[model samples]
Target: MGKNILVLTGSPRQGGNSDMLADAFIKGARAGGHTVAKFATAAKKIGGCRACEACWSKNTACSIQDDFAELEPLLESAATLVLASPLYWFGVSSHLKAAIDKFYAYTRPGCKRPLKIKESLLLICGADEGLGVFTGAIETYKGIVDYMKWQDKGILAVPSVSAKGAIVHTEALKQAEKLGAEI
Candidate 1:
């Protein structure tokens, strides 16, 4: 049986470089028989975590009562998570960061809720040509994988691609698709 995959995209621009990479990955994942669900944080009304520590107190993933409630079900059901984003300040965009912060609701001390995710993949794009530009984002991704105890499926960081649709000229898209299929 194929796994349920949840792909979270951080780019605010529709059909942006990062989004394209996500599309390629989704295409391959679907062809591989995996069920994929995608959520674009930029298009939602999600907010950063408030650090209230009141997670699940009211039978909700979060107490702020926003779009995260809509994502809770997907998060709980997904076996693999794919985070695709355009690197901002050497890290993930604020939109994706906010959604990631809300993950605290599931891991708060004493919270009984469980996350079904078993593996994760990262896709990042940046304007800088240097490969080092992706260090911050990669480190953050690594931290999340470690904390969640999920397998590190893979990471595709394409540098020097800032213009929208620039990724179309690179081999990263094919690599992303292959990565998805292998997953």
Candidate 2:
């Protein structure tokens, strides 16, 4: 059996470590007969979500519209979601930050409702190996999981990988593949 999975690559660099990790995960998932819809934030033109409250008052979705309009369906329909991004200043890339902000539709007054994600994973890569490296990003990821009340599959954080494709260290790539296969 196959599942509909949405993979969001929230990296500023096309071939960055986070992107590679996402690709590895997607590849493993495909090999396991899962259907994946992969999108790169760097490839799309999106803006930060403005607090218009239009999705609640105006409609049942976001008001500050852009490519995100095309994303809502896939996001809502996916059985599993992989939010992978390179750690930028202890958090996700600006690209992903914007995408996440638009999810405000799910947080508006009328639009604010419980999200029912079947399964989810947070894949993050950072350059610093400090003990608290992933703390900030982990908080952000946990916030989403808590908001949606989604099944938290797991979280993978790779440290000391700053350059592109450097996540080959810290066992992140292998973990990503394993996560996909298991998911």
Candidate 3:
């Protein structure tokens, strides 16, 4: 059976380098017979975790009451998660980080481990080719995977690509497609 893959694209600009990489991964994942659902969080209304600890108390996943309400169930149901973004300040974009931070709700008291997803993948891009450009972001995601007890399916960090559509004609796109197919 095909796995359900949820792709969270964190790039604010549509058709940007990271977004293109996400699209490529989606293409490959679909070609590999996985059901892919993507969400562009740049313009979404998701907010950071309130640390209210009201999630389990209120019997809700999050207390902020924004786009995250809808995303919570999706996150629980997905079999795989793909976090796609452009490296920002050696970290994830604010948009994506907000959504990720809200995951605290699931870890609140009485919730246990909240996510049912079993696997995760990372697709990150950056302008600089210097060492450790993606280290922070990679470590952050790896930590999340460890906390969630999910498998780290893969990480594809493309460097020297900053502008929109910069990945076109590059081997990165092909690699992304191949990664998706392997998934």
Against the true structure, whose TM-score is highest? Answer: 1
My TM-score estimates for the predictions, one after another, are: 0.98, 0.89, 0.94
Model 2 regions more than 4 Å off? 56-60, 109-116
Worst 10 residues of 1 by lDDT: 105-114
Q: Of 2 and 3, which scores higher on TM-score? A: 3
Using lDDT as the measure, what is the rank order of every candidate, best first? 1, 3, 2
Tens-digit per-residue lDDT, 39-150, candidate 2: 8876788888777657745453676657876777788778888899988888888998888888777755676433445788888888888638788889988988887777
lDDT for 159 (candidate 1): 95
Best by lDDT: 1
Candidate 1 per-residue C-alpha lDDT over 40-141 given as tens digits, one digit per residue, 9 for 90 to 100: 999999999998878888898788999998899899999999999999999999999999999998887665668999999999998899889899999999
Q: Per-residue lDDT for 1-183 in model 3, tens only? A: 889999998999988988888888899989889998898888798988877777755466876678877787678778999999999999889999999998787666678437778889999998898648899999999999999888998999988887678778479888888888898
Worst 10 residues of 2 by lDDT: 107-116
Residue 6's lDDT within candidate 2 is: 93
**Model 3, CA-based lDDT:** 0.86
TM-score of 3: 0.94
